[model samples]
Target: MPQRSSTFNPHDPVTLQRMQSARSIHSEIMGCQLRKKKVLELLPPFGAGKDYPPQPPDIETYIVEFDGADDPMHPQNWTVRKKLRVMTVLGFATFVVAWGSSIFSPAIFVISEVFHISTVTAILAISLYVLGFASGPLVWGPLSELYGRRPPTLISTFTSAVFHMGVARSDDLASIMICRFFAGFFGASCLAVVPASFADIFGNKTRGMAIAIFATCVFIGPLIAPVVGGFIVTSYLGWRWTAYLTSIMGFSSFALVVYFMDETYPPQVLVEKAQFLRRETDNWCILARQEQSKFELSDLLEHNISRPLKMLFTEPILFLITLYTAFIYGILYLLLEAYPIIFYEGYGMAFQISELPYLGVVVGQIFGGAMVVAFEPMTYKRIVANGGRPIPEIRLIPTMIGSMLFTIGMFWLTWSGAYHRHVHWIVPTISGIFTGMGLISIFLSALNYIVESYLMFAASAVAANTFLRSGFGAGFPLFAGAMFKNLGVQWAGTLIGCIALILVPVPVLFYLYGKRLRTMSNYAPT
Candidate 1:
């Protein structure tokens, strides 16, 4: 104390060293706070940030330096295990969403009876559900990109569950129908968010598996939902159980999402941190470029709002694939509605037993999922063998094989039902298996090619496809009753098969000339 000197230099080496260390610590603390802010926003509650400072350059520096993964913040660079967990959870959420939409189809009769309504109006529930699916994704897909995947997903799912509960409790058809539409509107959140999420987590090489898993579930969900719902309704539980069961599934999915799924949207994560840093440090400069743009809200809304229509109009590959997929989906839905009428009413198969025919679509979907999984590794190997660059046409190999079987399934199911043959019904059921397999295979390939050709706008492109696909899915059933009534199952299915036959060459054409077409087109991703 007595040796203390007033003349002491603050720039003395010891003092300077301490000062430097203090600044360094302060900067680090600031960064940690920023990162924690992002972690809270981007990750669910369980993945809270540890105290350790991020061991890299600033967020922007890392974003650029690591090329993409530097953003240790990126959901894409999330450890393989973490990413897989997210996909599984999100995939299941997707399952529940589609499950809710179609779970009530077979229960339509029960609903009709309960509401004392015409069968046609009861079926409105199904159509309105699909209609919600058709429209909701247009907004949700882009919004998730702007906001994080979590908030929209949680909100939508929770809202959907609440609405589904309403559907269960409603006493009248109009109330139920309104509730059903909103339920689907909320659930459609899963579809819009899942694909974009997959693109966020997986890279080009392994995306096929991610896509396969997701697309397989989306396609199979409806098929399985009706099967389970049919059994539930026929088991004396009644149609309302369909709504309750779906709500339970949805709530369970929400729990899983809250636990497992992390934010995959890059912009949202950055903006989250930007928001925190700006608030805490009171330094506006702390905001990231994306956050600094005051137009973000408007841009986000516009991007989400415009994408579906934009992709539909601008991209030929997206347009064509959407058209093709729409027809396939439409027919699939039509068959879902008509099968009960044809096999149960006309052929006298018991409702419970008649559902066994759906085993065909289920079997086919399993095969299709396998084909897609198999196709991916094979294509990757071939590309690696051929000096590492993949040809767009390579994707068509599975499509080619699947389409043939698809055509066969259509003919088999159509004619077998039309002739009213007593061949154990397993014949058409097996055909359904093949059709499902083929349809999914082709669908995966088509979607992959479209996304590859439209990376930045993949959400929009998919939105366009979903719009058409669900539109057709919703409307197709309405026509099924009339078509079968006038044309009979054989001619009706044959007519659809003839259309599919026309479509068979589309993939082949794309396979052979796809690259050339994408290369020449203005917006086809070249």
Candidate 2:
């Protein structure tokens, strides 16, 4: 009855309040609808099949996404200065983790003497640390996907630093082994996640150059570590200083990361934005597509935990690439032991001086990276010519070349250093340049190819690669002493070189058939 009075109610507080509330509710509902529309338009279609179970029909949902292509929040749209700062911090983090892997090499003798363990047992410190690398990526990879790059990187690196400190203070072999393994496990985060972060920020055209820089940091870390660790071990500061030094570097990296790093993962960013919008609007329906599904332990296990393993086994591109990278990584670690045999013992060089040869490998890595960077413009032109879509095979060119160089270096180092001891020491040491160049070239190319091929799944693909390579890395050094000692450096080196030669065609095969394989893959972009 009162509704019949449609006029003369301007001064009535009750009527005005009711009318204002109605308008406010209508505005909120319209706003949500418009937002949902914008989100759908901006987002790529989820395709026919749904990844998550359907939401209840009765509930209205508003998805949150980047505003548009120019959305500054997008990682790709971040300012070059900020991206470079982030890259530098990440590069350092990666370098520190890698450095930690081999720093213990120089301390092996000291550890053997102090702990009254065999040289082989003393080597466990390095082996276990690398083994940790194998396992850490399994968890870190999934966590990076579920959370974001920054959190996993910070947590793992900081924890690794703590473990390094644990190794530093440990008095017993058991304690040392545990600490070293855990340190490596935590340190593996940088290996598993940094490449993905690089991919997140850099577009395909420039990603190769970024990955090349990353590869240099990676390979150079181990190359430089022994030099530093050797001096530290031979000093009054003692072998423990090696672990302490790594811990210091780790902490420094963590500090830098805390100061400079921002979330680069686009999905995670959108999820955070959605959470912020929900808080501001007091609307529970505002959700990121990533947030649409309720968190379940089963989903996490099935999707995040198992996906990399599944992809690793199922995808040929991933498997072969991982295998090749793993072999190269293994050889790199094996050289940690082999170099000492050839230089320190065989060549009768001082322990401190033997470590210097690693610098040759470092130089080679720099050249390799430079080569990849140099090729980026040509690749970019190809990308442009192909209508702005990158062909993953184009990345394999360097790998093909590097494979031959790696094989050559392997033979040169082993034969000259082992068989022709009278040959100048520089002969063997200089060979490191080729090995280093080949190592970095193959590594950089494989990584760029993986990132381009898998796109959104780059993290998992990389994790799979890391898992296999770290396994190789962990195992190689354990056998290096015996293999080089028994097989003689020449035969041992020849064996590895032969393997490298056999694998030479891997990149070539992929380069020729990669497109077809990608088209056939479930994980790779068609």
Candidate 3:
């Protein structure tokens, strides 16, 4: 075997970054190693493929290529079925976290009455929990980079289950608020880590579908919560069961994660491999990133925290899409505020029966999943036909149509509410479905685009999306009731719809200018 030597400076983020970049070279060279067993192999040239355009030019200097591109330890070399199984476990973990966020929304009044707080303040249980969702990612995203994704994910998720149990048992307002926030904070791991895991496992060709499936599962969690939460509220068990049952579900998610998930982050896997090889062959030259870089907490924190923000500001494509996604996310959470008003206040339905309206959003999520199934392949085919280089803009095509549908659905709900007696309840309920589809379409597009554009930095880009959107998710509901109460349902919805309509230009601008935008950034592909 041939050996090479270079000065090792552990703790350099640039060197750490190059360690990650080496995996692509390793993956690209997979099968070629068989023919070159006795020769020095050149690094794999990147770009003009569904994989990212390539890491920074310097990454090739610090690392060894894998034995071949098909090396089984490399996640990209995993079978499709194995890749998806990891996604499934991660997706299920996500479902319970989101379920905890929204399931208790319908019971806010009950919680208020029990705790003797105002209904407005009671709504903070939901919003504060979402605030935790936003903030947790800021911490967890960096933690995952320091540790691998799995430890932080498992630890956070398991503790989130404990917090949910605390939420169930809380007798005072402060207790519930504190417990819910912690629960959201811990529960955020699945959201923060899993998409990055997806990117780690799949190449660009299939990442869209992976995100779509995980996102579909995520969308379903909140929408379906009202169905079960409503029954718990109306039943003798009362509102606390919403948290109690969700806590139990969180525990179940914990077990699924511990049993099924193995480390998928490529750099971590390589570190383990390097360790094993060193012990086996007594070859200290088998270097992985962890061995090459000294761990520096302050540098890690600064780089992880500031780099995403830096990329966020400099990259116009990321800014536009993330802002759009943040609004769409906020609106989705805002619906938790809107739905009970429409059904309970407007139609005078019982709590359990009123939840039937949320089924509309569930139906819309399904339709959105189907749209991805239908349209994603078309998008993929176009990328393939373009000689394998995927344009980040391809993600925006569905988003354009989604923006229009979202606007129409918002208007439909607004106008239909004024004539509820003249029109069947089904009319406005279907509006939820259309709006749900619009929401999901925009979500999937933006998420896939972020994954495509940022590539390795996806966790950070997504964290930025989560921060702004989750803030909106948290803040919007604080005012949701006020808007509907003061303006009435029709005009309040019009207020929202008009904003969405104005932002409709977001996708159009990106689609036309994405390439030009990428040109301005060192991060985005040309």
Report the number of the highest-TM-score candidate: 2
Question: Which segments of model 1 are wrong by more than 4 Å?
Answer: 1-72, 272-284, 296-304, 382-393, 520-524
For each candidate in turn, give its C-alpha RMSD to the true structure in angstroms: 11.2, 11.6, 10.2
Query: Which ten-residue region of model 1 has the weakest summed lDDT?
Result: 62-71
Lowest lDDT 10-residue stretch of candidate 2: 25-34
The lDDT values for all models are: 0.74, 0.85, 0.79
Q: Write the per-residue lDDT of candidate 2 for residues 388-424, one digit (tens) a residue.
A: 6678899889888899999999999999998545799
**Model 3 alpha-carbon miss at residue 156, Å:** 1.8
- Cα lDDT tens digits, model 3, 1-526, are 4544534455554345445565542332121222343332644645566563444456434444344444566787788788777888899898899888999987898877877889889999999999998888877765665567889789987999999999888878899999999999888877768888898887657888888887887678888998889888989998989999999998988898898888887767777787777787785566665445532455555566555566667777777787888888888888887877887778888878888888888888788767866777788888888766667788888898889889989989878976667877888998987898898888988888887776666677777777777888899889999998899989999998999999998889898888887888765544
List TM-scores for all candidates, in order.
0.83, 0.88, 0.87
Higher-lDDT candidate among 1 and 2? 2
CA lDDT of 358 in candidate 1?
A: 74
